[model samples]
Target: MKKEKVVLAYSGGLDTSVILTWLKETYGYDVIAVCVNVGQEDDFEEVKKKALATGAVDAYAVDVVEEFITEYIYPTLKAGAVYEDDYLLGTSFARPLIAKKLVEIAEKEGAVAIAHGATGKGNDQVRFEATIKALNPRLKIIAPWRIWSLKSREDCIDYAQKHNIPITVTKNKIYSRDQNIWHISHEGGNLENPWNEHDESIYMMSVAPQDAPDEPTYIEIEFEKGIPVKINGEKYDPVTMLTILNKIAGENGVGTIDIIENRLVGMKSRGIYETPGGTVLFKAHKALEKLTLDRDTLSFKKIVAEKYAQLVYDGLWYTPLREALSKFVDHTQECVTGKVKMKLYKGNCVAVASVSPYSLYNEEFVTFGEDDVYNQKDAEGFINLFALPLTIRAIMNEKKIKEEKEVI
Candidate 1:
């Protein structure tokens, strides 16, 4: 009898590689490994080879970098959704896209189940399972960490050795990492201990702030309706633009954040994120919005931004709420076209100048000197009317005080 097919979200890493073999050996299933590449630094051919060697009947490597940026990253960027005001939601957003690919491949391959290597303790487990269930509810989801006896990374290492699985991770260097075009995240190992300061060596995409060059790097970014279009006057496609900016900003140590974030699993997990290009894009986009958006719209959108970040972080990317939020965010981006000049120095990405065609700032109205656009005498009446309620309250209080003295 043929075994039921399971499409495993394979990364050729320690956990997934071990899962590839363990799933087949334990469940007696024909494993089809699928690896979705979202601009991570990995050799896909090697990954496929490892999957096949680890007892997977077939393996696939899908490149979704362009789709990831244009579809997922751009919307979140437009919303300015930063998780807890620090995390850029890099790993959070990538999981949905990867899970989406898993569903597609599972359907195409006629697989009955989808498997993921995400541990039960982390947010990725929720992210993957939630996206999978949202997209294809019928498919049976198998999460190895939640079930299997392998409880720790050390156990995974022992299993890999016993199964002859090739893995790069060792006990000495055991920081669990996830990487993509937007950013790279480091967790596990010393990060689990909040008292342990992250070693500079763990940073992959960016230099340490202290190690950055003395001279600052200035760059001009141009956006078209909140989507980044050009860098320093040269237009680039999404992939190329991000790649260029990541290198430049990483060199300047532009984005490295260490935070203890609340996980969707109701636990506090500490992680270090490196988001060089994303940092630059977000700062530049915010600067453009400041110049173009009115005070009320900008203020209200901040509330929307917090909710949007929460949705993305919780892996509700496929829900109607996220779609609705995206529509709202897109509507707000109509005038978010402009050029922003940013200064990058030692992990700081500051927008120094911004200009937009729809800029609401008026030099004549805001100038301290005399201007024809406004009359100084008009302020007296405006202030009087604005302060009328306060003045009335004070007069009433005085009358009450005088009446109380007479009564006494």
Candidate 2:
């Protein structure tokens, strides 16, 4: 009897490893394990071997590093979309791309369904299923976490041990982590208790501010239309620049954030993020925009940025609103070409100077001592008109109070 084929979004983690075996034994499905690498460090060979040994009919590891950065990270960066002001949208952005590949593999291999190890409680489940539904509605989604009677990681481990499966999870160190080129997120474990201070050792991309060097590191970034093109006067591609910046910023103990955020799953989830490269990219880009963008555009874009961040965080990546917002953002970046000099010290990214060809800052007009433009006396008329409504309201309030006292 030929069993139905199911392609899984496999990561060689404890949950997925157990899932691979469970799908075969419990459901009688021919499992095809597809691991998509988006810059997270893993031994692909060992992952593949484990998948094969754990009852997967076929195992494959796909490298999507360059594409991950170029297509996903760069576009998000261009939009300046940071989720909840701290997250660089690492996990959220990677989820859709991985789901797309799973859909492709399912179509290519004639698989009847696709599965993911994301638990029913988490946001990844929503992100993955949403992408799958948008990209390929015909393909069925088998979310084992929702259906399986095995309640916890402990149950999964017990199943693995009973089935002679290799297991790595232990009770002592049980943090759920997601990593990519943009950032590494640490959750679970002691993070559930908001009072528990995060152990600094768990962080990978950045060092603790208390341990940062006494001396500061300074760097200059050159942007071509809001896309960082050079560091220290040397031009490099997007990925390469990010790689370089990550090394430099991480060494200096920068870009670590601890926050309690409202999850898309209607829960308050606490996390610590290490985003060395992303922090540098955002800081430099902001400094460049100060030089390039006009006051009104810059102010308006802040509102757009807040909405954009919320949309991305909520995993509305494929919606028309997000697409429309992106179009407006891309327009703002047209003249966002510039160079910004910044100083990094003890987790602080400080902008020292910035210059752009399209700079709206006119020093001659802004200087207080002497200027041909921006006459100081013109402000008297401007202030009068601006305050007229407020003055009228105050007078009316006084008249109303006097009338009330007379009636009393």
Candidate 3:
């Protein structure tokens, strides 16, 4: 008789490591670990080694940094999708791609089930399971956190210690963090208490704003069809460009946001997110859109952006609505090609200038100085026609008031 195999989404973290051993010990299942790297600062070889060492029958380290950026990150960026007006949707969008990889590997391995370390309370559980269900509904979904006896990170630490597993997380430093090329998020521990201020030591990708250098950092970004193509007149691939931008922006303390956001799980959670490069990109991209996009299109796109953010945050990326919204966003980006100069200083990212060939801002039309593009006398008729409805309403109201007074 052969044991059923389970494909586990492994990060070589304390949770997944303990779960890998636990699944083998408790359930008698042959566990295969899969670590998908999306530009997080981790040694993939070491993660694989740790997974194998922790009793995984086989382990794989999949590098999808380029695909993550081009397919997932860029589409979200072009959509201008920012959750709750601040979150860059870094972890949100990445979860779907990760789950997709897990499903693919599970299919390849002839596995009966797929498992993930996402907790029952967080939004990630929904994200992972949604994508898995959407892609491959037949595979069993095992969420250890929802069923395991270990109640907290401290318990996970104990479990790992007892199993003699190699883990970096300890009781003293137990902040739950998720990192990728786009951003790093810090939650749990002190962050659970909304009144408690986040310590400066928790900063990972960026320096504290107060500790940033006195001088401002200026950079220019060029976009083609609303996708960033070059920086400072030099074109680079997606991964390298974002890596460069992260270095510069992080040094200047450009992106660090602490917010109490409404989780998709129907709870308010506090998190600290560091998205240095993403913040600068969002500001610059929005500036370019302002320069090139028409008034009505831009206004409607704002509404679309909010909905897009909701879909990503709620883990509906693989659904039909998200695809339709992306198509609409792509069409909007057709004219959103331009250059934007940004100023980064102590946590502030400001767009200093923007220019586009498709820009509708014509100096000849709106110049206060003498210009032939407009007739000075044209405003009177336009205003009169625009105000006619308001004037009619006011007249009706006055007539009603007069009638009431006569009745009195």
Candidate 4:
């Protein structure tokens, strides 16, 4: 009889490497490793070889970086959804795509089960499982971290040594890392302490601010419907454009944020993230939105953005409401096409200039001198009507005060 096959979301890292071996030894099942490349710069060939050498019956490396940026990154940025007003949602955004790919492969390969390395306590396990269920619920999920006795990184390392699997992992550098096209996040290690300061060693994607150039670097980013289309007037593919921007932004020490964020699994985790290109794109998109969107739409969109952040962070990307919210966000992006020039210096990405073709800015109406576009006297009736409710409330309050004083 043929053995039941399982599709594992593998990264060629220590955790997934050990899981690949463990699944074979414990379950006596066929473990097929699938590694999705979302532009983390890892050598997929080497990863595939390592997976095959360890225990995987078959290994596949799927390139999904362009799809990831276009489908996942762009929509979130267009909506201006930043988790907790600080997190760029780099890791969060990648989870759905990775999970979706894992499921797609699982179906193609006719696998009975899908497994992952995400721990029970982390947000990613929720994200991976939620996406898989949403996409294809019939497939069984085997989360080893939740059930296995290998409770800590140390145990995993010891298991690797015993299994004679050649790998590179140390106990001292225990900060869990997740890297992709949008950003790289560092957690665990000393970051578990809320009061601890994030050292420069934690940053893997960007240089330290102190090591950045003394002079500021200026760059221009062009957008079409809130999606960044060009850099310095040169158009490129979604992946290449972001790579160029990441290099430029990182050299100037652009994106580095440290925060203690609430995980989806009912725990607060501290992390340091490096999001060079994403920072530039998000800020520029928001600045363009300000100049283009009307007051009401923009204000209401701010409220929507807050909720949108929660939804995405909680692994609800495949839900109906997320699609509904995207429709609304699409309308807001109609006029959010433009170019923004920014100055990057020492971990700061400051917008210096921004303009959109559909911008509501009017020189004549805003002019200090006399202009035909406006009649100064028109403000009198407008103010009176606008203030009517306030005026009535104040009069009623005065009357009530007088009655109280008389009674006293």
Leading candidate by lDDT: 1
TM-scores for every predicted model? 0.98, 0.95, 0.99, 0.98
Worst 10 residues of 2 by lDDT: 70-79
Residue pairs with colliding backbones in model 1 are none
lDDT of 1 by residue, 1-408 (tens): 978999999999999999999998889999999999999999999999988988999999999999999999999999999999899999999999999999999999899999999898888888998999999999999998999999999999999999788999999889899999999999989788999999998888999988999999999999999999999999999999999999999999998999999998899999999999999999999999999999999999999999999999999999999999899999999999989999999999999998889899889999999889898999999999999999999999999999999999
lDDT of 4 by residue, 1-408 (tens): 899999999998889999999999889889999999998979999999999999899999999999999999999999899999899999998999999999999999999999999999999898999999999999999999999999999899999999988778789877788999999988888888888888896677789988999999999999998889899999999999999999999998888899989898888888899999999999888888888999999999999998889889999999999999999999889889889999999889989999889999889999999899999899999999999999999999999999999999
- Between which residue pairs do clashes occur in model 3? none
What ranges in model 1 sit over 4 Å off? none
Where is model 2 more than 4 Å wrong at Cα?
395-408
For model 2 the local lDDT of residue 89 reads: 81
Off-target runs (Cα >4 Å) in candidate 3 are none
State the local distance difference test value for candidate 4: 0.92
Candidate 1 vs candidate 2: the TM-score winner is 1
Which residue pairs in candidate 2 have backbone atoms (N, alpha carbon, C) closer than 3 angstroms, thus clashing?
Answer: none
What lDDT would each prediction earn against the true structure? 0.95, 0.86, 0.93, 0.92
| Per-residue lDDT of model 3, residues 14-113, tens digit only | 8999999989987899999999999899999999988888899999999999999999999999999999998999899999999999999999989999
